[model samples]
Each structure stands twice: as C-alpha cells, then as structure tokens.
Target: MTERQQQRSPSSGAGAAPAPPPGDADAESGPTVLGFAPDTAEDDETVEPVADGTAARVAVGSDRLAYVRRPDLVGGLLLLLAGVADAASVWLPWDRDGDVSGLSLVVRAVDAAPEGIAELGRTGLWQPAAVAAGGVVLLVLGLLLLRPARGHRVSGVLALGVALAVAAAVVGRLVDVGWDARSFGPGAWCAVAVAGLGALGALKAVLTAPRVTTVPAERLLVG
Candidate 1:
C-alpha cells in the first residue's frame, strides 16, 4: 500500500479513532431498556386546577369587613325640630304684660309645656334672653351629639346642664308658690310640672344620641 494509505488506515494507532459512542436517544432506539422513570411532562398534565365558587366567595369575604353607616335620617329630623321649636319660641307673640291675673292658666300652663324651655315669660327680655341662651347651648350640644366621634363626657355634661336648668326652673316655681302659700298654691305645681317635663325631654335627647364607636371606618372617617 502507498504511504498515504498507510497513514489514513484505522490500523494506524496515531490516526483519529471512531466518533464517540451514540448518546441517550440512539441508545433508546436500539433496545427496550425501560425501568421505572419519572415522566415529568405527564405528571404536570395530571395536575389540573378548576374554579371553585365557594373558595372564591371565602376569599372575597376575607378581603372585606363590616361597617355601620352613620344615622342621617333620625339626626336630621331631630335637628330640624329643634331648630323650628327654637325659632318659633323666639319669634312668636309671647309677652309678659298680657295677664298676670291668669298666671295659673296661661303662664304656669305654657311654662310647664315640654317646649317651654324656649318660652319667653312676661319676666321681660332677661328671662327670654336666658331662655334664648339655653336654646343656643342646646343647639350646639345637639350638633355635637350628631357628630359620630364626639366625647361622651361632652354629651353627659350637656345632658346634666339641661336637666339641672329644667329642674331648677321647676323647683324655683315651687318655692315661689310655697313661700306665698296663701296666693299661688296650684301655680307652683304648674311650674314644677313644666320644668320637670322639659328636664326629662332634654335628658332623653342627650343620653340616647348615638355615642358608640362600632367599626374601624367610624374611627378612621369621623375624626
């Protein structure tokens, strides 16, 4: 053989050897060498997820919380009534000189009325003035009560003041009649009754107004 042929021959140990052994794919093609082996793609296909209505509802509920809406309807009406009662008492024809003779039927009767807190007695501008001031105070307190986050102490003080005023007015009338036992017997009782009823009404208003803090939204929004 020629020298070139000899150099190229497989027998020549120095020549490049056969290409490397066939890889995994070629080996699989040659024989059924299957044993237990994980089929990752098949495993992935088996894990199918589905939409769950109950689970979705639970998730949505978990994200949200309950809240109590402030009471606009009741508070609004109360505020309006208070305003009208205050305004009419101040503007209406309520003079003292009308008749001191009918003190029992007119003065004592009207004074004892629940709305008598705003009534301006014949005692002139001073009594009316005091009544007007009390009315203004009551209006402010009502406004404060309407607010969701007002202090309880504030409401309590307001209620106590109103109650005391009403009580004092009634008690004073009793004293006026009792001291003059011969003249104003029943008229004193009339004064006491009027003052007592007014005290009760004012007490009710201040005590029952919404004062509880029920939710996070209330604290966050009502500052």
Candidate 2:
C-alpha cells in the first residue's frame, strides 16, 4: 500500500496508541454530561438560616379591629333631670317670705354694702342661692358631656363634685339658721333632692364606662 493509505488505515498499529471505548472516554472528558440531579447546595432564595443561639423575629403590626362599649341611658337621664332642677331653683322662692326668690337673694348679696354683708349673712339665704347658681352651671356642663356618652369619667366626676357642693351649702345654711321646714322654702328642698340624684347617677356612669382593646393579626409568608 502507498504511504498515505497506510497512515489512514485502521489496522495500522505501529507508532500509534490504542483508542479508548466511547463510554469511558465520555465519562472522563465529554462535555461534562450536563444533567439535573438532586441539587445538594442550599438555596439562599427559598431557605433562611438563623444563628445557633438566636431566634428569628418577624415584624408585626396592629392592623386589627377594635370594640367600643354601649351608652348609659339611665345615667344620662338622671344628669339631665338634675340640670333642669338646678335651673328651676333660680326662679323659685328661697325663704318663707314669698317675696324673696333665689335671683333676688343673689342680687341683694351683690348690691349689699360692706356693713350690709352681715345682714345678708344673717338671713342665710344668699349662700344657698349662690350655690344654686354654681350647681346650674356645673349640672349643665355634666349633662353636655354625658348625654351622648362622650367623656363618661369626666362628667361623672364633675357630677359628684356638684353633689358635694350642694350638700355642703344646704347643710351650712340649716346649721347657721335652723333645721325647721319653716326656715327653708321649696327651692332649698329641690336642691337637696338634686344632690342625692346626681350622686347616684355619677356613680352609675363611672361604673359602666367602656374599655377599648386591640388584637394582632397573623402575617402570610411566601417562599
């Protein structure tokens, strides 16, 4: 055979190494045999690893619903009545003499001279009339705060204060003058009744006031 033919022939063995099998050759060097085997590496995108001695904390918020208490109708009504009684006491007679009303007592006390101040005090009418005026203002404020159930604690405390004032004024007058029915008129008795009713209503309102609270909601995590 010619020299070129000898070189191309498969049978030629001299000066040439033996060829390896296809399977062994591929396992060693062919294209790395790309394939999808079960991946042994940790996926940072899907899995999170916490420290050995630390806990993983997720941030949460108070995005939930809240509940409120109902209005106190009975307490509101009592406060309203007390306010009305206080206003009426201004026009009603404060002494056995029908000519002397609460308004006239206040006017006389305001217009009295330094020497006449003692005369006004001796009658013991001006003190209760002045207290009645204060009661009217306080009771009106309490009613406004309590009617719609807004500021229950404030209104209740205010009502209690008015009751104490009215009681003190009436008792002081009775102590100074006399504790007979002839000493006081219907207006004075009406003020006494308001003190008792207002105190009861204030207690009820404070006891029945509402409390508010919040709850946390769960968060959804997507991997």
Candidate 1 weakest lDDT stretch, 10 residues: 54-63
Model 2 per-residue lDDT tens digits across residues 100-133:
6677766767766355757666766557565666
Residue ranges of candidate 2 with Cα displaced over 4 Å: 1-70, 112-126, 147-151, 212-223
Query: Runs in model 1 with CA error above 4 Å?
Result: 1-83, 95-126, 150-153, 170-202, 205-223
- Give lDDT: candidate 2, residue 71: 62
Please, what are the lDDT tens digits per residue for candidate 1 over residues 54-137? Answer: 211111111235333343334334433443444444444332323233222344445555545434343322333333344455
Model 2 has an lDDT value of 0.65
- Give the TM-score of each candidate: 0.35, 0.57
